[model samples]
Structure formats: C-alpha cells, structure tokens
Target: METSATVAFVVYALLFGWRLVDAVEGSASVAVLAGGIVAGYLVADLVSGLAHWVGDRFFDETTPLVGQNFIAPFRRHHVAPREMVEHGLVELVGNTAILALPPMALAHHSLRPDSLPLLFSGGLLLSSLAGAVCTNLIHRWAHMPRPPGPARWLQGRGLILSPERHARHHRRPFDRAYCITTGWLNAPMDRLGVWKAVERWLGRAARQDPR
Candidate 1:
C-alpha cells in the first residue's frame, strides 16, 4: 500500500506540475488561468469540507468495506487528532490521493491546455487534487507542537489550515468547521446550511436519521 501510494503521489505531482507549465505556456491570458487556479482551490476547500462532514456525521466505522478504510479513519481522527501524523507518508498520501489521481490522469489525456474551458477545469481539478492530497500534512501541521517555519508562515497567512482554526473541529460533537484544507469555504457553506439540508433531505427520503 505504501509503495503504491508513494508512486501515485509522485505521478500525480509530476502531472500537476506539467499541467501548470502547460497552462502558463499555452494560455492566452495568464490572469484568467490564475483565476481558475484560485477557483479550483476554493472548490477543493468545499469538497474537503463536505467529505469531512459526511465522514464525521453519516456512518459508523463498521459499515462494511468503507467502514474500515474510510469511515474508521475519521472516527479515529476525532479520537486522536495527531494519530495520522504518526502514520507513514505512503499511507497518508495513498489514502488521500485515491479520489484525485484518476480524474487527474483523465484530464491529462482528454483536455487541451489551450482551450479556456478545458484549461480552467484542468487547473481546478489539479489544484483540488493538490489540496486533497496534502490534507493529512496540513491537518498534522495544525496539531504539531512546533510546526516548521514554512508551515507556520503558510498557516499565518491563511494559505493552509492553522492550528487555531482546526482546534474548533476537535471540540465536542465535532459538527462545525468541517473543511480541513485551506478552510476557505467553511464559513459560507455552514452559513448556507448546506450540510444540514443534505442530511435533512437524505433522512426524509430514507425515513431515518442520516446524521
């Protein structure tokens, strides 16, 4: 698992680098591409939050296959906030990269970098993958006793999830502040009651509490 995860991480990293280079080289408007990248990052933030919220609120860690691999980790995470930091890098990256790698590979093969729609979507997809792939590292930084200088700088600038911001998630019930990447979308998503609406709809549809 570790080996495969490392290989996947490396492959995706190279692809992302190539995508950026292609976008910059092929783009007629660097400013527009840059905006796309920013938009992509924001999309990632929202996706991460939505995933986190679902994992935290929806299922138990014993629901068949997903229970062990996916649901369990979130449960463990809420219990031991720094537990993932102790895990090997391969485990970290592999678990997070699964959802991201395939779409990225498809984008690389299918999208033309010069086309505006393709370029923006490609940028958004890759940036979202970056945010997702690095989620564990960013979350760990939020718990580190003494995070490295660069991490501290990034956290301070709100470029990554900071310790102060993440601490709120660890509090009782663990309901709010679900986004663990850049956390740029937490406020708006929560204010809009998006997760609540989803839960309510799912419960009504199924005639059982989904939360």
Candidate 2:
C-alpha cells in the first residue's frame, strides 16, 4: 500500500507539473500562479502545525483507528526523536501521500487547459499537497545530526524546518514551535497561544459533553 501510494504521489506530482507548465504557456497569469504557490506553502505549514498540536495533545497511542499508526509515532517521537531519522523514505512519506491523494486527484482532474482560475487554484492545492508529502522528510532532516548539504542550506536560510527552531518543541512541556514544515508560522502562532487557546476551548467542550 505504501509503495503504491508513493508511486501514485510521484506520478501525480509529475503530471501536475506538466499540466502547470502547459497552463502557463497557454497564457495563464504568472502572477496568479505565483500567488497560489505561495499561499499553498503557507497553508501547508499551518496544517503541519495543527496536526502536530492535535497529535501531541488529545489522543493516546491506543485510541483505535489513529492509535498505533498516527498517535503512537507522534508520542514516541518525543521520547525517541532520532527514530524518525532511521525511517525509510516510504515509511516517512507513505501515510501523508495516501492522505493527500484524493484532493490531489480532484485538483488534477479539475485543472482545465484554458481556465486560468482552475490553473491557479489547482496549482495551490497541488503545491500544498506536495509540501505535505515533503513535510515528514523535512522533519526527519531537522532531527538528523548531519543532514544533506541542501537541507542544511535551506535550514540555515529558514526556508525549511531547522533543528534550532524544532528544538524548542522538544523542551519541557513540548508545546511550542509546532509548525514543522517551514517553521514560518511557529513564532507568531506560539506568541498568540493558538494551541493553548484551542486546548482550553476543547477542554470546556469536553467537560460539557454528554458522552
């Protein structure tokens, strides 16, 4: 399943790239395409943060559907951060690739050769999915003692997640710097106490639940 998903993801990504180029050559606005790509990255970063926050806060590793697969690895990462570094590429990206497929397929199908709006929106969605696919690998690199040179360069420039930025999340309370994609939203989100606020709201709602 993982291998299949990974192959599908690569194929879809290549297809999207080919279609995007054709759209551009067909007179789609370069400015709109650029804006979509930028927005996609930002949205992907925000999503990574939210998923990190939720996985860290709410569910345990035994919670049925997401238990062993999602929640367990997330919980274990805090105890054994380097374990992620040891994961195979397919192990690291397979689940995210599976998660990203439906939307990616929809966007691919919706993309029209002559429609600039479809091109822009499809570009945004596809780029966001691409970022999602890369998120785990990027996170793994941040935990590595000596990541590849390209990753190191990107980390230094703050273009992707960095060990220095991610370290704070590993500190006691394990609460800040949840944005592990580019780590761009971490500071502002932490300063605003967004996760804390959400936790508090969930706490209140849970207490009032009849279940």
lDDT of 2 at 128: 86
Q: Candidate 2 regions off by >4 Å?
A: 25-28, 204-211
Alpha-carbon runs more than 4 Å astray in model 1:
23-28, 204-211
Query: Clash totals for all models, in order?
Result: 0, 0
TM for every model, in the order presented, reads 0.86, 0.91
Assess each prediction's global lDDT (C-alpha) against the native: 0.75, 0.83
* Count: clashes, candidate 1: 0
Candidate 2's clash total is 0
Best by TM-score: 2
Compared with the true structure, the alpha-carbon lDDT of candidate 2 equals: 0.83
lDDT of 1 by residue, 1-211 (tens): 5567557756865876587666675446576677777887887777788778777776676778788887778878877778777876667777766666677667666776776766677677777778788887888888888888999999999999998888867876456788988877777877897877787778744232223
Candidate 2 local lDDT, 113-174, one digit each (tens): 46677667867887789988999999999999999999999999998999999998898767
The ten-residue window of minimal lDDT in model 1 covers 202-211
